[model samples]
Target: MYYIHLEGVPMQCVLVWLWHIVRSLTSIEKILLRDRPQTLYDLSSKGTVPVLQLADGSVIDESVDIMKWALKRNDPEHWYKENFDHQDGLVNKNDEIFKKRLDRYKYHVRFPERSYQDHRADVSEILNEYNSLLEPGPYMFGKDICFTDIALMPFVRQCAHVDLEWFNSSFPELGAWLDRLKESELFISIMVKYPIWNESESGQYVTWE
Candidate 1:
């Protein structure tokens, strides 16, 4: 897995780590994008983070695509068994719309057209929509955590951290949902800091099984 560590989250990398934990997979090499060798670009010209090269020499670059590939092999918790359309719908909204607003809000100075408050208001609208979805209790679909929950959790966490006080006050349900996932054993395990991978030396391999 090749990923860039940003604010200690490394968004998409953590998504793949969640699947790896549930599937009991083993032997993944963690490479920092900043220290990635030219071989990585040779493998995929797109040069994105969280790139996974399988034993079969096939590559999976997109984050959600990597999640689907892993789950297809083993999904003991049945994360993909139910809510197919609903899951896809929410994940798409998160990746496409919510992420854009989040980036703008996070780096509002880069987007001079909109004030920081305007960018935050745009994100708040989407957060409110997701908050309403958690109407009665936990998780996106129901009590059980499904594909949608895992897919959107990291991004929501990023937004919440921007202003945690406001997030908790404005959307308690969403804040709670983020906290539950953040405090999980699985989340904690993946968060162990590894030395930055270097081309001149052997990189760190995280054994998941």
Candidate 2:
């Protein structure tokens, strides 16, 4: 979806799920493998990448809905639950605010006049809030490696790319979090490859164990 929006490819289906899976479980995933949906339940007028057609012929156009349908049927490693942050769910915080700041900062060029630094300052302030709540074990909280770690790592990855040397120098703890995610086979495998979603020659999915 990101690829399609970014590069403007006439997105077909899930030829690139972004996240890795050995096999397709939901019929939607499988159908996407063969071809992308053009008119999901006659909802093409709505417009979206994963307009999923259900067993009852109902269609869902949201990304989260599509993922829920596909993964609910097959989540052996519990990545979804872990990523969701059922307890306290600080990951939701990171996803909601941190990622938004990171997005603005990473794409500051679109905003013009304002530099990436302007947006990055907001991201930095949020990270500092996380840091304030942190206790050095490297997780958001004192010792629990919660969903916050998993949910927020991708934007951190993109931040690193924006300026690895600068990013590493500024936020050591955040860098460490990024390092942990990068070292994990789940993140690397799921993130490193994909059809780039027809956008920036990169995909927009992440999977984990």
Candidate 3:
């Protein structure tokens, strides 16, 4: 597990960590990306965090791909059941549309073309759609947590944290949904802090059994 820490919390890494907890995956080395280590470049020239290198030497780099891989191995919770096409569509919208607006909204200074409020409004459009979808209560697809919920939660959390007060007031359903996931045992367990991976020192090994 190669993960990036932002604002003292795992970003994309949350997806992999959540799946690890759900499936009880164990003995995985957790490498914290801090100063751009050479080992990271060696494994993946892309230098992106949340890179998973299996014992067989195969690498799973993308966060969504890693989630799918883990579910394929052991989905005791059956997170990847029917309605995969719908799930994939939602995930794609999150990764493609929501994520872009989130970055702009979160870092408005970098995106000068739009005012901070405008960027925030752009994000709200997507949030509004999700808020309606979640009106059935609890989760994206209703009742049980599914792959779509896990895939979108981290990004939604990021968006909410941008302006929490506004989020809480505006998207009541979505906000409550996010709060539930944040308070889950799985979310809290994966949030354990690890020392920055040092070239000379062994990285931390994470396991949940």
Candidate 4:
């Protein structure tokens, strides 16, 4: 099963996207952080949503780890190809650096000392760097979709959402690249909303065929 929040939870969005890409059979539980269910707290009180509860009763809590687990089971796209370290490095940078800038920029009220433009500029540098990397693209790594593309797109989407006008005008290639992923059937498929979880119920399940 997958636990997700509807509003701008990039990790949850990415995990669901990866599952669709891998064609994995799984159920999903929608959750709101403000009203976290006991069932979720039972799994990992400290852990956030996007937890993947395996049938064996083990749980994968980290989003990237979940992506690796899903892909390892069946990499029909062969995303686990040569230069995997390089691909993983990109994902690491997105998680570590880009996401940090994103949070601060998006939730700038939490850090009143820093101006929104300062954080946005920091994130823009990261996007510009990615734009340079993606110059050879229709996708991130040459002509096809890869692990890095799938893993990073959701975060980029989040950043763009912060200011669509700035993102579109300032980062044209990056904007265009994101547009492709957003328009994809794969992205659209996983974005289907499930009912929000109720604490008293056993909850609904969404299994793959």
Candidate 5:
């Protein structure tokens, strides 16, 4: 069976959503960051959530890597259809640039040196890039949801949540795109809350089938 250890957080949510969209049936174990189980430690010493344990016993811990693995197995919608370099470029920007800014903006207290507004300003150019990309169609790659859209939507959603008023006014296209992703079956299915896993219990795991 395909086994996944996840939390309800955005990165984990991305993996869950991708697996669901690809119809990758999996045994999902909900985890708590504060109270990670020994199994998690054994599987991934880094203790990262959204770790996927393949039936062969190999594991993939990175969220994006897990997405690639799932999609590579079956991409019915052709999320990676065309423009390989462009898709990789956008995904890279989201992960490398926007995500850092988003983290600082969302939890300004942790990054006390930079004001929350400063963090928001740092990602303005990236947001503008997304706005430009979406001008031709709703999805990032135009007319179809692709790797970049699913890869970056959660981070964008997090950013929009930071200052709803500013986000709506400053980036209307992005705000609408975020809304569309939030309302999709892919988002909704993966977002269902599950009780945190406990090793002491018997048959306590959940399966996303």
Candidate 6:
């Protein structure tokens, strides 16, 4: 699934779900091009992150919706298959509640009154739930990595960085999971620095060289 966003696409937590699925499937039968779908805004001016353009010149703009669009076509990662039960109605809840808290925690200045710890506390409760789930495993979905695991990781990864010591002290299991993701090749491929607007000279989606 090549996210056909113009110039390039910025790396975010949401992209991880689609990324893991695409990598695991490794099926390039069709060039799933993702672009900031041609929009009234992009048509008039620069639009959002997920403007997608299809081979037939079709387009999709919103990022979160795009993840669903890409995932629906394939189930190699079972993103839609396994994670879709309450995903339609409930996925957005976590996205709404926890995601909002995460962003504020990462960039606490916007929420000026709240200390970083206070902001983290708001989200840590959710992470602790995940920690309990991981009682006897590494990946969120049993032995291997799954859509559920990757979907929520990027933001958590960002939070872990907000205060490594603090997050470690507060939520060790979630912190451990974040630590594991940092060391994983997937994290290296997706999070590694590359030109946000241009593929490196080697012309890769991610180039950490």
- Which candidate tops lDDT? 5
Report the poorest 10 consecutive residues by lDDT, candidate 4: 3-12
lDDT of 6 by residue, 86-189 (tens): 44433565677888888888788889898977887887878787777666687665566655666667667776777788778777767777788778876676
TM-score of model 3 (CA atoms): 0.88
Estimate every model's Cα lDDT from 0 to 1.
0.74, 0.51, 0.75, 0.74, 0.76, 0.57
> Model 6, residue 136: displacement in angstroms?
3.6
**TM-score, cand. 2:** 0.57
Which stretches in model 3 have alpha-carbon errors above 4 Å? Answer: 1-34
Candidate 3 clashing pairs, residues 3+ apart or interchain: 2-50
Candidate 1 TM-score over all chains jointly? 0.88
Query: Per-residue lDDT of 1-209 in model 2, one digit per residue for the tens?
Result: 12122112212123223343334333222123234444332454654455555545566665444445545655554445543544335555654677677778888988777776688787778766655554367666435544345445555677678889887787777777768756766554433222423322233433333
Alpha carbon deviation, residue 37, candidate 4 (Å): 1.4
What pairs collide in candidate 6?
Answer: 4-34, 4-35, 35-51, 35-52, 36-50, 36-51, 36-52, 37-51, 37-52, 37-60
The C-alpha TM-scores of every prediction are 0.88, 0.57, 0.88, 0.88, 0.90, 0.68
The ten-residue window of minimal lDDT in model 3 covers 1-10
Best by TM-score: 5
Candidate 2 lDDT score at position 132 = 56
Global lDDT for candidate 6? 0.57
Off by over 4 Å in 4: 1-25
Which residue runs does candidate 2 get wrong by more than 4 Å? 1-89, 113-115, 132-134, 141-145, 195-209
Give the Cα-based TM-score of candidate 6 against the true structure: 0.68
lDDT of 3 by residue, 1-209 (tens): 33332223444446555555443434333454456777777778888766667756777677788788777866777788789999999998988889899999999999999899899899999999999999987898889988888888888998898889999999999999999988987677667665555667555554445
lDDT of 1 by residue, 27-114 (tens): 3345655566675686678776666667667777777887887778777878889879988998998889999999999989999998
Better of 3 and 5 by TM-score: 5
What's the CA error at residue 99 for candidate 1, in Å? 1.0
